[model samples]
Target: MTIKLIAIGKTDDKELVKLIENYQKRLSHYIQFEFEIIPDLKKAKNLSESQQKQKEGDLILGKLNPSDVLILLDENGKQFDSVAFSQYLQKHMNSGIKQLVFVIGGPYGFSEDVYSRANGKLSLSKMTFSHQMIRLFAIEQLYRAFTILRNEPYHHR
Candidate 1:
């Protein structure tokens, strides 16, 4: 199955960008993968948090195809170890899922509309992470998940 990661905003940190690229390259070795970024909203200073989420949600929803299984990276979502996450990936692949889409929402998180579109939610940690940092973490974890699936030496326990 193809896996796609969609996130809001750009990463300005050169180190983080480099690491994200590294993981993306490693991930491509295991699955059909793509990373798409939604540019941060313009004039966001004037919009209320709810308004911002609504506007961003529109763009987020627009990027999706009806058949894609969307998983949101949310603070209140399920938490899993790398091994479990790899098994999760394996289960979906075995189920004949086409494209597995994972989204990292903008500041103030996803709107109600965006929540409605998701098939599930995953939490990387209880601690909050910057959207840019989350991008790196998400991709790295995805790479690790595939490695664990293949019994590679990248992950222990």
Candidate 2:
């Protein structure tokens, strides 16, 4: 199955971009991975938080295919340790799906519409993280999950 990560806005920090790229390269060895950045909304300052989320949600939804399995990285979602997360990845891979899509929403988080359409929600941590930082964290974890599944030395229990 192809794994795709869709995040709102671009990473302005060069260092973070490099780190994300490194993990992306490593992930390519195990599975098909795609990273897509939805452009930041123009005149966002003029919109209310809810409105922004709606707009971002629309853009996110537009990128998804009907067959894609959608998962949202949300603060209130189920939390799993690395080993469990690896199992989660394995479960999806074994399901014979075409694509697994995980989305990192904008500042205000996902809209009601987005939440309604999601197949599942996952939390990386209870602690809050910047959207840009979360992109890096998600990719690294995905890479680690694949390595663990393959019994590679990259992930230490």
Candidate 3:
């Protein structure tokens, strides 16, 4: 199964960009992976928080195919340890899904439309994090999950 991570906005920090890329490269060795970025909306300053989320949601939904299993990274979503996450991934792969899509919403979170369309949600932590940082964290965790699955030394129980 292919894993695709879709996030809104660009990461201006070169260090974060490099680290995210590193993890993405490592992940490719395990399964087909994609990192797609939806450019930040223009004239966002004039829109309210809800309006912004709606516009961002539209863009996000536009990138998905009907067969893609959508998972949203949300604060209220289910939380799992590295090992459990790996098992979750294995379950999806075992189900023979063509593509598993995970999305990181823009500021102010996801719109109702986006939430309704998601198959599930995942939370990295209860603590809040910047979108850029979340990108790196999510990617690293994905890489770590794969390593754990293969019994690599990367994760120590």
The candidate that wins on lDDT is: 2
**Residue pairs with backbone overlap in model 1:** none
Estimated TM-score per prediction? 0.98, 0.98, 0.98
lDDT of 2 by residue, 1-157 (tens): 9999999999999999999999999999999999999999999999999999999999999999999999999999999998899999999999999999999999999999999999999999999999999999999999999888989888874
> What are the per-model numbers of colliding residue pairs?
0, 0, 0
lDDT of 1 by residue, 1-157 (tens): 8999999998989999999999999999999999999999999999999999999999999999999999999999999988899899999999898999999999899999989989999999999989999999999999999888888888874
Clashing pairs in model 3, backbone N/Cα/C closer than 3 A: none
Candidate order by TM-score, highest to lowest?
A: 2, 3, 1
Screening candidate 2 with a backbone cut-off below 3 angstroms (N, C-alpha, C), the clashing residue pairs are none
Error (Å) of candidate 1 at residue 110 is 0.4
